[model samples]
Target chain A: MSSDHSHLPSETELRAKALESLLVEKGLVKPEALDAIIETYQDKVGPRNGAHLVALAWTDAEFRQRLLADASAAAAEMGYFGRQGEHLKAVENTPEIHNLVVCTLCSCYPWTVLGLPPVWYKSAPYRSRAVSEPRSVLAEFGAELPEEVRIRVWDSTSEMRYLVVPMRPAGTEDWSVEQLQRLVTRNAMIGVEQALAPERLAP
Target chain B: MRGGHDLGGRQGFGPVNPEPESEEPIFHDEWERRVFALTMATGMLGQWNIDQSRHARERQHPVAYLEQSYYENWLAGTEKLLIETGLISEGELRSGAATEKCGKELRIPDAEAARKILTSGGPAAREIENPPRFAAGNEVIVKRRHTLRHTRAPDYAQGCRGLVREHHGAHIFPDANCDGEPVAHHLYSVEFPSRELWGGGAEPFDVLIDLWEPYLTLVDGNGE
Candidate 1:
């Protein structure tokens, strides 16, 4: 049917009408059923798993080596990688230069380790300027890059997802794995913020 | 029924929010709100507003609750509309669906699901099929293409001087002339002296833009 009619349906009206017709024909959508199914998988495979793997890597040098080299296999070994994990790649940030990621076109991310991408990552200002003026972009988030250090901007245009393995923060020298995991927020992995320190999180 | 990830800012067709800090308007149904949040978490902010008269027609027409399933169908339809509009492509739309499905399956909260879909695998992992025409360290020029459609390349960079820094692989080709094919193209890091992008005493070596291959051409020392 043509949408050229003078009177158009309100989104709410269309939704009500649409739902009314579909349910009449096919029955209830089992909305809660869908949610339960989603809950099972998330519990089974999600960011929490990715976080655990990151914690393991932080403690083990060998694990870190393998993680940076072949992230998918390494993550899979820990039971974190799955359907979307096949193309997962890990980028480690060092003191000299920092790596930041953006989809520019869309928010293509690695869900297993880093969790979900934020509103800003998929924003036009972030996408358009992040690659061109990364330093400035970082500055907006309060992340300043040294002039001497070249900023490497990764523009994710395909299925290849990225995670920023933030530098282990200073003064957290002896923090336990569980404690350290608290510092690894999703924003830190996006290069928008630095890894947290014990002092920063003190209540 | 717009593409989930097509935020209004990128399109440049709408005015900035009247109240930037206020919470955005939410859908009537909680599930609908969940879907909206999930879409935004991955940074797909586009939505379908009901055409005014149709909204009235629906109220007057009256329908069953079960037909609400059409809201989901409406979402699917909107995604197709975005693909045709060049706001996104089949690949992007498909991945968005995958994320939506995954979000539903995993029960991950909408914000969390959005983040997962945006940062995790989908188009982010797939390799750009075709390498860019240029290479890093090489001087290139951005091409000027004007249309009413949405594009990743900015207008300021058109016909401007830039140096290719690196080549990122191909993805969903946004150029409509190519007919919505997911062609391989390079994600070239093009350097634009701040002066070129924004006039006045800008930083010397500071340049910008990680442009796709289709946007560039070789610019020799004499300049193209």
Candidate 2:
């Protein structure tokens, strides 16, 4: 090990390294294995999967009905069942109502589809306020809902995960599933924001 | 115990500084990846179950639990579990050096196995012979519980009146599963109107929570 006396490894960094090395020496885990796990979450699983589901639903009314009726089976049909995704409930966004998802207890997200939750979704501000002052919180995300639109906040306190099937932007009816998927942002799925408008998507 | 991990309605936090989707990386730094991967790999050992893993993270002191960054908390819990389970010693965890050669009794998931297990991912819902006590549209009240231990029910949803939106079948009850045994119980998606939870003049909205059967009692009336 080379000397870096000028800046000792931070306690947090040191602790992480210590744990990894300890596991390896004990023959309990391989470093390569850890790398693989990280890679799986980093690239393999993410919002893209959820995007695919949303796009499919937009193009197919039957699939949309199935998604809202039984999100778990619908995801399974698309081969999207896994950790944090075993149980899923797709809440659709209509013109008259808005839906948002939050986990006040912890960041319990649909990993198989949405991948790992974003930093803000797991942060204290979003968690504490989402259930109470949701309009204010949504405003922060640039999602302003009218007073007439009812707000339904889903607080994930159990194994059940939620995905907001954001409304397809007005001009997206003729668009392809891939085109619609391009507008499905992670925030839209979490209910913090809505699906990107047609104009927002680069032409 | 009633730890600080529950952030339902307590106030005074600042802006939710969300990063731009294009700019935000999954793991902020190299160390985050290490901690995340370490937690996943160690968890696959099967020496501990998912509920126990959650309790480990939520069991931290209130101050530490609330203040620590997400990954920092994961490291704290991982360290605690390693020591408590006899997989890694306290001194060894601090020094990054192995002393006693334990953990032989544990199962190690290799790279391929790790991938498979995570993809297959453990599902908590288990089939139970007992029928669900409540059904959709049934009025129910969440009983207040002050147990100072691991609980899946949030403090905000407790002591409030709600209606059953859906029954999620039987799932492992966290309070009982803290010891790594699968105990399935009926879980329901209870929807509490904002007024019922926080009083009048509040945002006219509804909050839905997935609660186990034990935490709820059937309300005979339309609701007080």
Candidate 3:
């Protein structure tokens, strides 16, 4: 993944480097702290954490009850509570009702579970269109729900972050939590798309 | 204020061209990561709350706000916060050096402490003895006033009537909290029908938004 751009850093890159050096020199921020925050989001916390919770909800009925009842507490039970997810509200997708989440004002995502939000989530197009034309937006993601099913869009205006527990696809009854987790994509958890079907997972 | 950041329900923006989830990278480049980290680290300084940081970003001109990328907006917001809080002067920032040290004693968290603090997040919910003005099943209208500062009420819901779906207990009101006047208010999940917001062409659906008490007013009778 290395490129021959060692001598040609972008202007933003230069400014960031300059800011980091200044902050460090001023003792306002530590270099190690910066790396830790990046690493925490990059490696430790991610969609895999959310996938674990979704898989558990699919397999364990009692856990699903707790997750739906109070998402933050249930997330803490699984050791997945933190910044950007202080007040998580899990909205499950059912056959009759579809749930979609978007931060109209800003990208208020569940970073503790979903890690840093995708570029599109913060983009102008997604922010404006998600609330106005959710169905069309989901269609762009190739998520086409039935016409009869009611769509409920959750606009995250406050500190409350939303997590969409996608419905379990057909033909995955006997699958283990690990196997089911492989089917849960970050987009599905964000309610842009549905969880992968069993056939799609096959090579 | 009707800032560029609040872009819900308004039109003229084009289609949402989303990248395939399987292929999208977390950070498009190294600088994006750096900007993100810097924002979070400086935010930990406790000089400004999240709402204030958001207001800083929204304070930019509409054209600039729309043109700037996500991390670019974040970097801009960080610069505003630093200057506003007296942590660094514009001259110092321009020089890329510390001209004068901040007089106030600021507690800067180290990497380990930041990790711990991030893991155990700070919740905005507060324990207030005041009762909620609206309850579930009650019809309420979103106040139509616009303020030129930090506000949690989105423009799309302004003047729209919705049903109170749930009472979310007391939480720090962003409008007051951002102004350095911290006050607790009951937040509720208001459910507005799509037709109510978008008119006849809208699909049969409901949009739920969490609104603080001050942003709402109860309907007199007949559910409006």
Q: After superposition, how far is residue B122 of candidate 2 from its true place, in Å?
A: 1.4
> What lDDT is reached at residue A159 by model 1?
47
lDDT of 1 by residue, A34-105 (tens): 343345343444455655666677888999999888788788787665434566667787877677767654
- At residue A165, give the lDDT of candidate 1: 81
Q: Write the residue-wise lDDT of candidate 1 on B98-170 in tens digits.
A: 2212112222234354435433433422364444567668888888876534455655567788777655455
* TM-score, A chain, model 3: 0.94
Q: Candidate 3 local accuracy as lDDT?
A: 0.87
Q: What DockQ values do the models have?
A: 0.09, 0.54, 0.55
Each model's lDDT comes to 0.51, 0.87, 0.87
Worst 10 residues of 2 chain B by lDDT: B215-224
Error of 2 at B92 (Å): 1.2
lDDT of candidate 3 over A2-103, digit per residue (tens)? 111233347767778878777888888988889999999988999998999999999999999999999999999989989999999999999998998899
Q: Which rank order by DockQ, best down to worst? A: 3, 2, 1
Task: Residues B1-224, candidate 3: write the lDDT tens digits.
Answer: 78989989867767776666777778878888889999999989899988888999999998878877777788889988888899888887888988798787988889998898789899989999877778899999998987897888999989999999999888889898888777889999999999889898986888999999888888985323
lDDT of 2 by residue, B1-224 (tens): 56888888878878787888878889877888899999989888877887788899988888888767888888898888888988888888767788898836666777888888987878888988988878899989888889876888889878888999889899999988887667999999999999987889788899999999988888994333
Instruction: State the lDDT at A74 in candidate 3.
Output: 93
Q: Rank the candidates by TM-score, best first.
A: 3, 2, 1
Deviating ranges (above 4 Å) for candidate 1 = A1-33, A36-57, A61-77, A80-89, A103-106, A120-160, B1-29, B32-133, B148-151, B154-180, B186-196, B199-211, B221-224
For model 2, how big is the CA root-mean-square deviation? 3.8
